[model samples]
Target chain A: MSGGKLITGFAVTATSHTLGEYRARGGYQALERALLGMKPEEVTGEITASGLQGRGGAAFPVGRKWSVIRPDDGETHYLCANADEGEPGTFKDRWVLENAPHLLLEAMLIASYALGVRHSFVYIRGEFDLAYRRLAGAVEEAYGAGLFGKDIFGSGFSCDVFVVRGAGSYVCGEASALITSIEGKKGYPRNRPPRLTVRGLYQKPTVINNVETLANIPWIIAHGAQAYRTFGTTKSPGTRLVSVSGHVTRPGVYEVEHGYPVGRFIHEDCGGVLGGRALKAVIPGGISTKVLTASEIEPHRLGHFGDCEDRRVLPQSAGIPHLEPLVFEGESLQAAGSSLGSGGMIVIAEGTCMVRVLQVMLRFYHHESCGQCTPCREGMGWLHRIVDRIVSGRGRPEDVDRLYEISRANDGTTICGLGDAAGYATVGILDKFRCEFEYFIAHGRSRYDGCLECLGSS
Target chain B: MKHLIPECEALKARLPQGFESTLVLPCLRRVQEERGYVADGDIDALAQYLGVPRVQIEEVLSFYTQFRRQPIGRWHLQACHNVSCSLRGAGSLLDRLRERLGIEPGQTTPDGRFTLSTVECLGSCGTAPVLVVNEVYHESMTPEKLDALLEGLE
Candidate 1:
């Protein structure tokens, strides 16, 4: 709440998602202001200055992705909103879709004007019923109100939005695969040299952006980039929608500023670990980003960790030079050897089996692997089988090393980032809790008495 | 198939030009909605109707998990067994249901009322241990709640 709400400024009501409610909240004004007043390059210039990072997972700069297109280049441009929110433990986009759909639409309209897009698309996963309905409804309303079509607000800029729904394929969440999916093909990621902006979506210049990243455009265009910079840390301009789940008492979506401390965000904002349990580890971002142990997050809580001899209590190695300084930003987290990838924080409480947790993560990677690349297709299965063997009480001492070897094989071996993502998750957990894997292998069962679920529930 | 000529033409008209293949997924979904599963004849007919290759339709059908080839039971139970749900007894929840139905994940019950399956993350981790029966989500599930849901189902 401290960073200041932009898209979610209005409270949720029965009529909140309606176009009338959105117009009352001053929606589409950004489009009016942009079309009637500014040139295409000027809008893109403002976005580049805002430093808005991609909210999908990879913190790629949005403006940099947009800057590649020239509106007057005589080539038809396509702007796509990647609403395939399939990342595990990430549902923040669903919030925007269900509540502030018009914000995304208005933002898309402004983006279309900036990019010279005549036809745009929104590719959302099929699992989302309510979210899809709301977005489709918003699109219909806009078209009916003359917001879409040949001329809008007498600006002569013609744009139309098509809502393309995807079947249940996680790989389609990838940019090239999303385009391929929209093209009515198997969702296979294309090798880059064409880089989407060059040749994409029926072999034309296309710009695919994450849902949350595009939602910030209206805010940036409404107020200048300089004013947007006044919100969060200069390095990470504006707030992030963090979807916290797992052992947190209040497991929901939260709008956190960039520089907000992870410790305070978890302990105070999320109401701490459920059942007053001590925090064990935090998977900062999706399952792909590296896992941060409890002490690594709050290095100042040395007193809380108590014993210096305990292997998990050492936060000094987290690379924090000052006290209470670890905050939720891209630069700082990257410096600490992790990232805020997708802002899907899965909080773990004490008394949970870290080995079992890794097993779950590996299983996801295995199941969701697109099978397009050899390394991901086979290596994911290898890792999943090894973890399954370890969890099933037949794990060998060499199995841990085998897991690492398979993880190494998976790194950079795939067409998309899925292979590397699996490797990072496997290594991140093994690096932090090698002892748990060893114990589970040696004892043929989990040493910890509990799982990722709450113990109070029967 | 003969009766569906107008429906196919209307659907083809609604989609974009030169992208006739894009209608493969939507055609499969529409057929599946009407018939529970997309039969081989349906695929062949859709290929002829949409002017796309049969292999293209087949690949798209097999590539996505949503486009099923087999007939599903009345209650298609898909339980999420990912990290958040795994933490919140998703495995146990599946185990209980599996035991009650006496079938594996891909198997249908003898009564033809239930087919249990494990799914990846449904993106509702806040309410862990989620179960979806015929496209409707049942979250924060308990043993009693699951049993009652089965009882209430026709």
Candidate 2:
């Protein structure tokens, strides 16, 4: 097995975030090992070999991203950790920042060395109060120990880490917009013919990785890539820090291996849905990815999208675990028409209204649209207005089709993923729960009480 | 606004080389830190101090939602009305604050003790129903808890 767990394998005391405590738990060894022993190509090669996927919603492989920037490319490259954890339900990166910040700093240093980056930056969100303080404090500590500055570990490779905080803009979490924010401009996302890896921050080659994605680099470097691959499934190859909220009984961050069943994670690890009510739906990631109904998540047990539920037929099904009901990792969930995005699972209970849920989701997309593209800017507001009127007792049967039309309009029409993502969440909910929207539009009110809270069954 | 000269100078002295444009957000943060909000006079002085145009400063504060132009009350209550928080009674939570303060969102109380506004997300979804009073976060808040929080503020 790998030396320590992927991240957060240490006993977290009150002072564990300190450099001394971190070193005691073997924290900066990955950077030291990579700097003194391995070449830059080898460091990135280990990451590529490990198959570590990006934890920021999109499951892009981390290795493919690093490969874009050649170490000997003869250009000033930048490394950025997107610490703006603005996705509504995702706060796993904040866990690494508040309690395990040195892990991130050390990981960024390893990545910087690999990418030939002289200077790197972390564009943290402005609203992150404690995470900012802890990260800044860790950076100061790393500098004090000579771990960050000139000739780190006497490898003759030098890099500096800068914490450039954002001023409460969600779109800045996007790589291009984040670089733009760092350049001290309005946080509007730019067109991307030149990927950030090609012409990025200051018009130079830059590599931006999500905080959790970068946090895994030290582990991959410390242990060989082959050892790292042993942790999760062949494709996913690591544990994801799932931040569950909403109606879960015990809601917080739990590190689930990629092949771990989603049902077990929610039911056992998270203490099941709140008030012990029947499960209604789960927003598998943030409000961006598709929402999975209870049956969809437990598709093998009760067939929603045509997986065998009959006991006689289930025994013959080869890869499908009918008895266990496995919805493991990204591909498994994607098969159920959703993605394990950013590992943010918001569990919705039986009594919750889908219209109210979509209204909240639409309102978020509308408020956070950055207004860079006309499709997203107009489509988001239009989607929100339609849902708002439906919740406000204005009955129109045409509204559901209009919602679908608006969602269809947003697909691939915007510069950033926010537009397309908002559409995914809307269509996902609408696809699963069309009757609720239709009922609300026809009757000018929600079929249920519009209750999101789980008042326990009497 | 004239009292913010020292803060502006401090911001100017610390900006990274050739990245004077980066001073935009930090400068606005500084002004808001000194004064309760970024007034028009403060923006003019900041633009002049940092040598960034007034338009850049204007677009900045206008873009980021946290930076307020007008002066707000002592206790700025930001209730998260996003999915997780909304699922956990953030709607009624906002309603309760409105009843207690006798002011809707974007309005301050008659005495200027409280100002209410709904934020998109505070990222504390685990402890849903989050309410941010100034910089601190009050998570999984109830109407009773909010009432107590308001009482203790004075």
Candidate 3:
């Protein structure tokens, strides 16, 4: 709440997306300064010092990722801008694509130079038409202005950026799957002992970073590391774009610094729940993360890792509308089983059935599973079928334990993280809402009929 | 062997070097866009153009849900029936569409004007119960709106 915008400062302005308007707002200055003044190593150094984490739910250090690319290994180096944001309830990447396409271009330029990548690809989601159009226009403008192609701005660094559209698959967002998709395959994830850093596109060194993470690079390079560090907590030192939706009165994307309280994000930023309904649950991240009960989230506490050693105590600025920073007092949501995955904050109000929610989420996993591993392919369908049975009138009493057992079995057995994601989603939902599942099994109806009763409950 | 489609040859020529494998998804998309579905003839033509096996091409086509092997209706209605949309009553909407259209999700109407399919999340959760009709998104959909949309389609 107290932090200023770094990545999205130009999003709300009346400026057109032309290079002229972007230049007027101090845009591309970072790319210019980094290209002219700083060494490639220094650019990576500044990023590492800033403690910027990957915004694509992994939270890995951005600098460390850039550092690993063996740019001088005598092999072709490729950089992939992971814009294929397919996680449910996450659309923050679309903002940069729709509003500030040049930011991404500039960031890509800096990243390509730092990583020694000559060819790059923006693997965007297929549904993002406006983003694709805007980015295509920006790439054209950059090439026309000599920001791309041979001898960019007289820096002698040449890179070509291509925007690739994903056909339609959530699993393609995974790094390996994205690589496979780029290779014109079926988007099935490859087993990873040889990570993309070593052998990627065209069997070359590749570095894939999220769209939001790359957007932050221009800011860190333009502003010094210390200046960038002043925004958020020490460990998570950046403003994150949180997409808050579902049952909130004013659901949209809000750019809040890391360690901002989740309760404040809901009550203050999102205008609280719709119809003044009592909060039942909150999916703090995307649907892939565990759901947290309303009572589990402490009010005015910045959502951060509680048991993890990376906890930072934030200060309560004047008029910031929060209590003392949500410190690592005890076991927190991460300890209770959840993560800040992709910052897709979905607030669930009272009268929404947890069993129904799990069923819906499981259906998505079942549909999106690539069928590579048997455990995930079979387990997701089993979990979905069992949940569907429970939601309907034909659920057996033993189905709850069966659901838990299947979910546990599928967690770590797949070649990709989709298996773990599909398995772990049942943890918090079943743990917090066991009574709802029991209610559905006993009475053949939901404890709350918030949506509809069309699933054969009668 | 059937004659190769001219569009497939043109698309193959347009692809960048070393990106031959990357042509499958985009080529399939293009074929679907022009022909309404990926005909078997296009696959054979692509196999010839890209020099990949025909079974290999079929395998790629079968993996992604967006590709269709047969013809579809003029207006393909892809309703987001995933978690976010379902939480907002996308199920009831789907049921209404099914009842009105008198066909299942994978089936097209006899008149070939509409085809309904329930898809995963479309990344438009802010506007839940979203419907994507022929690549254009119609969000925050309701029963009346669906009826009006169906009426306006034909």
The candidate that wins on lDDT is 1
* lDDT score at residue A58, model 1, on the 0-100 scale: 89
Q: What is the C-alpha lDDT profile of model 1 across A215-318, one tens digit per residue?
A: 99999999999989988898998999999989888888888888999989999888888888788888889898998878778877764431122455324444
lDDT of 3 by residue, A127-164 (tens): 77777888888988888888887787788888888777
Task: Residues A1-458, candidate 2: write the lDDT tens digits.
Answer: 11225686777789999999999989899888999899999998999999999998888989999999899978889888999989989989999999999999999999999999888889899988889899999999998999887898888998888787788889998889998998778898879888889999889898989999998888889888998888888877888888999888888987777788787778888888888877888888888888876776776565543211232332221223233454557877766667888888899887678899998889889999999799999999999999999999995889988998999999999999999999999888877677788778878878788776653342
Instruction: Indicate the TM-score of model 3.
Output: 0.90
Q: Which stretches of candidate 3 lie over 4 Å from their true place?
A: A11-15, A299-333, A450-458, B1-17
Q: Which pairs in model 1 have colliding backbones? A: A452-B87, A453-B87
Give the share of true interchain contacts found in each model.
Answer: 0.65, 0.73, 0.45
Model 3 chain A lowest lDDT segment of ten: A310-319
How far off is residue B54 in model 3, in Å? 2.5
What is the C-alpha DockQ of each candidate?
0.66, 0.67, 0.47
Residue A419 CA error for candidate 3 (Å)?
1.4
Candidate order, TM-score descending? 1, 2, 3
Instruction: Please write out the lDDT profile of model 2 over residues B81-130, one tens digit for every residue.
Output: 99888877788899899888899999998888888999987789988889
lDDT of 1 at B45: 86
